[model samples]
Target: MEQFTEVFLEFINSWGYFAVSFLMALENACIPIPSELILGFGGYLIFIGKMSFSGALFWGMVGGLVGSLFAYYVGKYGGRPFVDQYGKYFLMKKSHVDSAQHWFDTYGISAVFFSRMLPVIRTFISLPAGFAGVNLYKFVFYTILGSLPWTALILYIGMALGENWQVLRTIGHEVSIVFIILMVIVVGILYFRRKQKR
Candidate 1:
């Protein structure tokens, strides 16, 4: 993993902003490039004046949209049987894709909006969205909308920690833990509110 991380960092170092787009695109396309590292590293560079935050963020989103389109096409054309046959190459299984599909089905469009803020679900939601054949424009709209804040937050985390982006990892994990707790509390409140109204 360290060797791979070094190679990835080196690639980004050589190419500048385009490297962030490429890696982020690959990540959204099911290649697992770790956006945290990419954005965080970009953030560090911004601190050093090597890259602009907006430029990094813009290309990151563009690359993500492009990669998502690729995956969407794949899932739309390939379907479950194709995934069942070839998913292993992407380090995936039918079950993983199925779980993503189930989430998409259960939650409808909001799933697309929120999934971009989550981890595993963010990666695979495009598959089921494609398979289900949701409106293309709406998918693009919601995807970009959902992705913007996440991209900004990740980049900010990266920038804040500068060269010590690993520290951002700990920060991200803690944030996720807190987010989950907050979601639980919010849901409980809503549930009780509904009961009282009834």
Candidate 2:
């Protein structure tokens, strides 16, 4: 995780805002690139006067919108049946995939909006949204709305942290671990409950 953060930081440092957009697109694509570090570093650049807050924020949001398209298409076309067959090879579980769909169905707009600030949920909410046959305009609209707070907060923190932006790298790593554990627990509960019902 640390290495990933460093690699992304270097990549962005070299290419400026383009790297921000590119990497963020990949992150939203569900590639696990950690937007906290990406946008935070963008903020740090703003602090140093190398990039503007608006540029970083705009490109970051654009990248998220573009990146999410990949998952959306995959879900729209391939769907649960497709993921069910191939997911294990990629270390994904059917339960995890289904959970996203369940949440989107159950929570509606709030799910999409709040999930954007969460760790794993934020990364994956789009796929489920796609699976649920959400309208394209609605999906894009809420995705942007859902994305704004995190991007702005991380960028602002990165700007404030300046040379210390790497602090967020550590936080991002920890947050990911916690979310993984949380998912495992949720899955376990769902499994046991299903068993008892049977």
Writing each residue's lDDT as its tens digit, candidate 2 over 1-198 gives: 455666887888889889999988887766667788788789999999999999899999999989887778777888878767875665555666666677788898567776776776777777887777778888888899778867887898889898998788769756545654665598799999999999
> Clash totals for all models, in order?
1, 0
Q: Which predicted model would earn the best TM-score? A: 1
What local lDDT does model 1 show for residue 10? 85
C-alpha local distance difference test of each model: 0.80, 0.79
In model 2, the runs with Cα more than 4 Å from the true position are: 86-99, 172-198
The all-Cα superposition gives candidate 2 an RMSD in Å to the true structure of: 9.0
Could you estimate the TM-score for every candidate?
Answer: 0.86, 0.79
Q: Where is the poorest 10-residue window by lDDT in model 1?
A: 169-178
Q: Candidate 1 has what TM-score? A: 0.86
Residue-level lDDT of model 1, residues 1-198, one tens digit each, is: 344888888888889889999998988887766677778788888888888999999999999898888888888899867877887888775666777888899998778877777766777888888887888888899889878878888888788877686676556656555655676698799999999999
For every candidate in turn, the CA RMSD to the true structure comes to 3.5, 9.0
